[model samples]
Structures are given as C-alpha cells and as structure tokens.
Target: MDLTEQPTFAFDVFSKACPSRGTLEHVTGRWGALTLGALYEGSFRFNELRRRVDGVSEKMLSQTLHALERDGLVHREAQPTNPPRVDYELTPLGREVAERLLSLIHFVQGHMDGILEARERYDTARGGR
Candidate 1:
C-alpha cells in the first residue's frame, strides 16, 4: 500500500457492525423510502414534501430528511427570506439509489394482485388468523 494512498473498505450490509447497514436502513425505512421517492420527482419545500409523501408526519419527514442528508443522499437548501424557505432534493448518489428503489417499488406495485392473492390463501389456510 502506498503511504499516501487512501484505504478502501468493503462495506457489507449483512454485517452487524457495518456502517452500510445503517445507511441501508435509512434508505429503505418507510419514511426514508417515501421521502426519497418524493424528492426524486424534484426539489420540494418542507411542506410540499410532507404533502407529497402523504401519511408522513412533519416530525418523521424532518427526521428522514436529516438522516438522508447525513448519509449524503439528500441535499437541503435553506434560503433567507421573510418566512424562511427550505428545499430538499436528492443528491447524485441519492438519485442513483432512488432509481433502484423505484424499480423495486414498481415491481411490487405490479405484483400487488398476486401478493394479495397469496396473502388471502395464507390467511384462509390459517383460519383468518
């Protein structure tokens, strides 16, 4: 290894202590996923994002944005104004992650009928428990 060369780390999400696990959680959690998907459409102000991500409370959205921002997946911009304005958008890395997540989202949505059917079958077999 060259003295001045940076060391590279192999991050494995399956490892309990791996930092990537935390980031993966942040990217895939309910609020995190919704927040990222909404931002993927475009930049949005706080309230706008709250509305777009429907069901996410103001507190959850705020926390999700903070986590994503810390993970380098979200960019937060604040402007000085009469009432103060802030916008959230995906960083380049975030866009890439969102693209992959959207693929999975679409797949799940497309298969929802089958998924529901499977659930119905499972419930029926279990006597609706």
Candidate 2:
C-alpha cells in the first residue's frame, strides 16, 4: 500500500474542512466531557476529579487534564507542599463551554424519564408482545 492509494472519505481530516469536528472530539472524548462537566462545579484536585468521575483511570484523567490545559480550556496549579497538590479548574473560555455543557446535561436529565419510557415501549414492541 503506497501513499495516496487509499480511498477518500467525505471528511478531509488532513485539510481541516470542518471546524466543529475537532472541537466535538475534544469536548466529547472518553474523558474530556466528564472532565469539563466535573470542573463545572468548582476547582478540584486530581484525586477529587478522579473520584468524581467514576470509571476513569488515573492515567486517563492526567491525559485529559493535559489536553484541556494545552487547549487553554483548563488551568492547572501546583501547590507548594511535600505531596505537591495539583488542582484543575476551567478557564474563562472553558467556563463558557462548561455552561453550555451543563445546559445540555440538564436537558438530558429532564428528558430521561421520557427516554426510558420510550425505550421500554420500543423493547416491548420489538419483542412481539
């Protein structure tokens, strides 16, 4: 397989055709979304964030925080101490995005009952009952 021999897809990740794809990926990554949502509450230490976001491993949390920091969406501070506590919080830009994310979360929570009911109905219907 040589270069330029593969089929081309609709999206040109090389050319950066779409603006939202990268942002969407960053915001909805395995740990990115959870990180943003958690930071919405307030600044939290690494352990606190890990505990708050269930199922997230320490490495993933660290990677997510680093990515968010590089993107300027998160601020990381290290305290001067023997253990050297580290905390993360959203920047102004990050806060704006977090607000939007909160709204989306609220919308989902509000409709969860209806969604569950719909799912149950769908399952029953598909079961041929």
How high is each candidate's TM-score?
0.91, 0.78
| lDDT tens digits, residue span 16-108, model 1 | 999999999999999998889889999999999999998999899989999999999999999999799998999999999999999989999
Specify the highest-TM-score model's number. Answer: 1
lDDT of 2 by residue, 49-123 (tens): 999999999998998888888888999999999989888999999999888887988898999999999999998
Task: Give the root-mean-square deviation of each candidate in angstroms.
Answer: 6.3, 8.5
Error of 1 at 78 (Å): 0.2
Candidate number with greatest lDDT = 1
Residue 50 C-alpha lDDT in model 1? 94
